[model samples]
Target: MKTFKLNPYRIGFRTIKTAAGMAIGVIIAKQLGVINFSSAAILVVLCVKNTKMKSMQAAWARFASCLMGLIFASLVFELLGYYPVVLGLIVLLFIPATVVIGTQEGVVTACVIILHCFNSKGVSLDFILNEILLIIIGLSIALLLNLFMPNRSRELEDYKTNIEQEFQLILSEFSEALKYVDIKLDHRMIAHVQLTIEKAKSVAFMDVENHFGRNDNSYYHYFTMRGEQALLLYRMVGLINNVSRSDQLHQQLSELIHEMSQNISGHDHTAIRLHDLYAIQLQLKDHQLPTSYEAFHSRASAFQLLHELENYLHIKSKFGSLKK
Candidate 1:
């Protein structure tokens, strides 16, 4: 039998925020004399999502859905008379209404509200007031807690550094592979780069959400450029893997790759890199064509590599301009 090992010290910020929000909501609801204080806690648990924008959106949806449920319950239980059959009818109508209003995220919360009405057997003015107060307490606490998110710009910068480091490593590996055939390439590096880019994009989006008036699209543009570069890098790696021998052309390409890796963090090296890449293209054009099938394939791979290198340089240049 395998024993389950759990890390007791590892808790995420989201978990902490949700827990704090729930405690606060429940306390406030009880102090305000809400009979069903647990509903406030439930709302907190459901409303506190990953990002501030998401949390706010969820809160609004839940509030709307709860209101709809309250209205339906008031009519069904008061007019139709409280019964299990009436509760069934409410569910049948409520589900479609929530879906139509685009508040499906609050479906469970809506059901909870409807259940509260059923338990009371009817919707009294006090019960409706209590439900409204609970909604206010729960959503207010969740929104306030979510607003306390840490500075995500720092996290985005860290992601940028990590992604650049990975790119440098991959480029260095590519340079080495250009010079020798025995060096095995780790194809996983491209996958890692792809994953890091996605994470960076997500963090950047969160950063955007944290600020209300900031119109900076630099992070979004930066991640998009990186994503495009990753695709090019993937193709370059595939092309490099086909080369089996080092000649003057391969040596020059290796030097170019090394230079690129060294300047991965630089701001304005794109022009210089583009110049060098153009020079390499000219050299490849002037070089003698291969006669053997293997040589022809190697030469074709080299051309493809240079083409991708040119594209990568252009993307870097575009990214730098965005920063300015």
Candidate 2:
């Protein structure tokens, strides 16, 4: 028998918070003797999100939508009387109204309120007040649960470090490939880098939204720069894949790539790296052309790689300047 290792599936903090908030909302609604108390729990499940800003926005939208639904249901059902046809008309009219008012996020909750009115046989002042109470209970619980969002800066930093390490490994592999020291390269690392960059950017944006009146978006900007550089890395990898043979040009380009990998960290010396890349570009331009088509293609690829390297350095420089 062979032993198998299982991958871990971790539950996110937001999910746990939502569950706890829903439980609390149900308890509060029951204690207050609000009819249809389960509706409050449903609203809590719907409104709570990963960040406090999002939760607050969602709660506001749901509250507004519920109010509109209550008013619309009362008018339509009271004037025309409760009928299946009236319910159909309400759905048709209310959905468009919610969309027009930009409270579309609350559409489902609005429908829940409308259905409660139908089940209760008519919309009355008491029924409307009970629905409003449910909405308040749910939104209040969600808001309180999301009040103290834990700072994710440390997690963002960890993502950045992982991304940097992966980038370094990719550059080291490129250097070895150019030197004819490695024939096998894992292209999957490119996809991994892309995924990591996306995760970092998401975390950074959440961090920005967690605060108020803070204009500093250094982490967001940093991940955005890395995203641009990742595109250049993709192109570089494509060029490297085309090289079937190595020569003197390959050797020189390999040395340059090694230098680039070293300078990728502590981007303070990016100016110097850009200068070196320019010199290499000029040297490649003026050098004698190869007779063989394959060698010529290889040199051309190296030239393109140099262009990408220069762009990468410029992006690093711009990001570094933002910090100062």
Predictions in order: lDDT? 0.85, 0.82
Candidate 1 per-residue C-alpha lDDT over 1-324 given as tens digits, one digit per residue, 9 for 90 to 100: 999999678788989998888889889899889989988999999988777878889999999999989988988899998899999999998999889989999989989999999999867899999988888899889999888887776777788889889999999999999988888675689998899899888878877776767756587778888899999998887788876564457888898999999988576777888888888877765777787888888888888888899998888886675462
Task: Put down candidate 2 lDDT per residue, 1-324, tens digits, no spaces.
Answer: 999999988887778888898889999999999999988989989988777778878998999999999889888888887898998899899999989989999999999998888788877788888999999999898888878688887888788888888888888899888877456565588888988999889888888777767656888888888889888888888787666555456776777778778756576678777777777767765666778998778777777777788888888887784341
lDDT of residue 196 for candidate 2? 91
Candidate 1 TM-score, C-alpha based? 0.92
Model 2, residue pairs in steric clash: none
Candidate 2: which stretches are off by over 4 Å?
1-9, 181-186, 214-216, 241-246, 282-286, 321-324
Q: In lDDT terms, which candidate is top? A: 1
